[model samples]
Target: MGLLAFKDAVHLVSRTGLGAEWDMIKQLEGRSQEDAVNWVLHSAASGLRPTPRMTPWLKLEPMRLNDMKTRNSAWSISQREGKLLQAWWVEQMLATHTPFIERMTLFWHNHFTSSIQKTLQPSLLYQQNLLLRRHATGNFAELLRAMARDPAMLVYLDGYQNTKSQPNENFARELLELFTIGRGQYRESDVKAAAKAFTGWGVDNNTGKFIIRPEEHASDSVTFLGKTGRFTGDDIIKILLEHPRTAERLTEKFWLEFVSNRPDPALVSVWAQQLRKSHYDIQRFMRTLLTSEPFWALQNRGTLVKSPVELVIGTLRTLPYPRESTQELLNLCRLLGQELFDPPNVKGWSGGEHWISTQTLLVRNAYLSKLSRGDLNDKSAAGVKLPNASEEQLVEWLLPVKPLQPLPTTPGARRLVRSLLLDPAFQVS
Candidate 1:
C-alpha cells in the first residue's frame, strides 16, 4: 500500500483525473482523502455545461431509403463530425476540474464502442458521444436501454435493418457475446435463439426510435438457456443483467480497463461483491476501485497503456493549450491510431502493448514536440500560439509521471528533450 499523504493523494488524483498537473495537486494539498475524493466527484459533476450542438450542413439533409445502396460523401460528413468530436473531448478534458467523470466517460466510450467509420454519418456518432458523456455517471440500466435504441449502435451492429424473415444475428450475437458476456460463457444455441427473438427490432428511417412490428417479430416462443418464453430484446437484456456471468464479466472488464491488466483476485472479487451489493451502481463501484488499498499498489501504477484518446486529450488538458486550429491536431490524433469514435473493428482496439510501436513512437515524439514548441506549422502552414502554453512549461507538464523531473539531460540536453517528447509514461495519462 502507498503512503496516504498529500503527495500520494496527488498521485492517486493524477491517475483518476485527466492526468492532472502538480499545481492542481499542490492546490489539493493537505486535504483529507475524503475531501480530495469528494473534490473530484463534485468538480466533475459541476463542470458539465450543456452546449447547443451544431447542425451539420448536410447536402442530403433528408436521406432517402432508396439511395441507401449508393450513398457517397457521407464519409466526409463523418470525418467532419470526427473533428468536432475531438475538439469536444479536448474541451471537456481541459475544463473539467474532476477526473472521475472524464475517466468514466472514457470507460463508457470503450464499453459502448461504435465507430463513425462504419456508421458513415457524423450526426449519429456525435449524438452518441453526448449520450455516453451525459449518462457517464448515471444509472447503467438506463444507459444500456438507451444505447440499445441509439442509431449509431444500431447501424454499427447491423441492428437497424434487422427483419423477421431474414434476421440479422449481428446485434444479438454481440449483445451477448461481446457487450454482456465474455466469449464461451453463452452457447451458440443461445445466440441463434436470441437472434430469432430479436427479429424485426429496428429503428425507423426519419425518427431514430425503437420500433418492433408484430408481424416482423419471430413470435414463436423460443427456449433460451433452458428457459422457454417469448423473449424480446428488452427481455433478453433484463435476463442478461440478472445473470451471474454478466457481473463477473463486467468485473473482469473493470479490472482490465481501470485497475490493472494483471488483476488481483482478492480485489476484483471484493469489487464484484460490492458492485452486486450496490445493485449495479457504477459510481459506487468506481469509488470502491479508485480508492482501494490495492489500487495504489506500486506495481499497479503505470500498468495501463494509455489509449490514443487518453494520450492526446490528457496532454492537451495538462497544457491547457489554446485551440486556435484543430484540423491538424485532430489529424495527428488520427496518425496515432485513435480517430475519435472510429475504432478499427467491432471488437475495438487491442490496446495493451499495441499502442506502442516504432512508427507510433515517432508520431508521439512529433506531437509532444508540437506542444513543447507551440508549432502549428505544416508543409503549407499557418502558425498558432497559445498564451497559456508558455507559462505551463514542459518539465512541469510531465510531473504526472514519477521522478518529478525531466529525463537525464547529461548525455545531451537536446536528446533529453527528444526522449521526453516520446517517453513511455506519456502513453499512460
Candidate 2:
C-alpha cells in the first residue's frame, strides 16, 4: 500500500469531503492512512448537526385557490422560502466539521433527485433534504425505502398520481435508471411492473407524510425482475437491493464522485463486491474506499472538476466572511450553474467537466477575484493573513495540490490570493 504522505492526506481530504483548509490538512500530516480516514469519517458522523426547522412559509397548509391573486401570493411565498432554504444549506456546508457528511448528502441528493421546480413546495424539498442528511451514510436499502415514500420525491416523480386504475411509471423508471441499476439493466416490462407495485404510494398533503391508500393500491400479482408476486413498493426496493447490478451501479457512482471521472472497471468490481458483502453499509463502503490503494494513487489526485457548490462553499470555508453574505454566496452558486433544491432535471446536474463552461468559468473567476479582494457585498477575506506569506506558501495554503506551473508574479495579499484562486489547477479538486 502507498504511504499516506501529506499530499495523500490533502488529496483524501479534498476528495472525500468538500475542500479542506490548510490547517485541516496540516492536522492530518504524518498520520497513518487508516487512522486519518477513520478520524475524518468519525468526526463527520459525531459532529452531525440538525438542519434548521421549517419556517412559516414552508409549513403553510395545503389549500385550494380559486383566484389567480391568491395563487400568485402563494407562489411568491414559495419562491422566498426556496431561496432561504438554499442559503441555509450553504451556511451549513460552510460551518460543518464533517464535510464528507455534507458531501455524501449531496451525492445522495443527486442520486435520488427531487426538484422543487416541479414540487413547488419548499417545505417538501426541505423535508427531503433532512431525510437525505439523516440517512446520508446509513443503510442504502433503508434510504431507498424512505425515498420511495418521501413527499418531495412523490411529487417530483409523480408518485402521487400513481393509482390502481392508472399507474404512473415515472418513479419506478427513475428508481431503476438513475437511482439503482443503470440504464439497459432492466426491461420496460420491469418498469411497468414496478410501477404497478408502487401504486397508491403517495404523500398526505395535510400531514406532509407518506400515506398508503389501500383502496387505490394494486394488490394483484405483478411480475417484476423475473419475480412474480403481489409486490408492494417495499418489495420492489428489496428486489432492487438484492440485485448485483444495484451494488455495481452505486460503486460506479462513488468512483465517479470521489475517485475519478474515468472509472476503472477492475477497481469498481472490487468495491462492488465489498459493498454487497457489507449489505450496502455506506459508511463502511466509504471508509474502505478512502483507505484503499487505488484512492491513494498519485494520478487520481486533483483530477476532478470541482462542482459549483464545492467551489463556492469550499472557498468560503477557507476564508473569513460576514454572516450576512449567505445570500450573495447562494447567488454565486446559482450563477455558476448549481442551485440548491433546483437540479436541472431528473438526472440531476451532470457534474465533472460539465461544471465548467466558457460562461461559467468567467463567473467563477470573477467571483473568486471579488472574494479575494473582499469586494463581495458585506464580505471580506479576514482569515488567513495571505499578505504576510511568500507566494510559494500562499499557493500551498490556498490550493489543494501543488500547481504544475509557477504562479504569476503578483504583489499584495489580495492580488496573490486572486492569482491562486484563478489558477488552472484550482479549477479541479
- The candidate maximizing TM-score is 2
Stretches of model 2 off by over 4 angstroms after superposition: 1-3, 44-61, 64-67, 321-324, 374-384, 387-394, 400-405, 409-415
- What's the lDDT for residue 12 in model 1? 61
The pairs that clash in candidate 1 are 17-99
Clashes of each: 1, 0
Model number with the top lDDT: 2
Clashing pairs in 2: none
Q: How well does each candidate superpose onto the true structure, as a TM-score?
A: 0.83, 0.91
Q: For residues 352-409, could you state the per-residue lDDT of candidate 1 as single tens digits?
A: 7788899988887777766655322322223322223322344334533554345663
Cα displacement (angstroms), candidate 1, residue 295, comes to 1.2
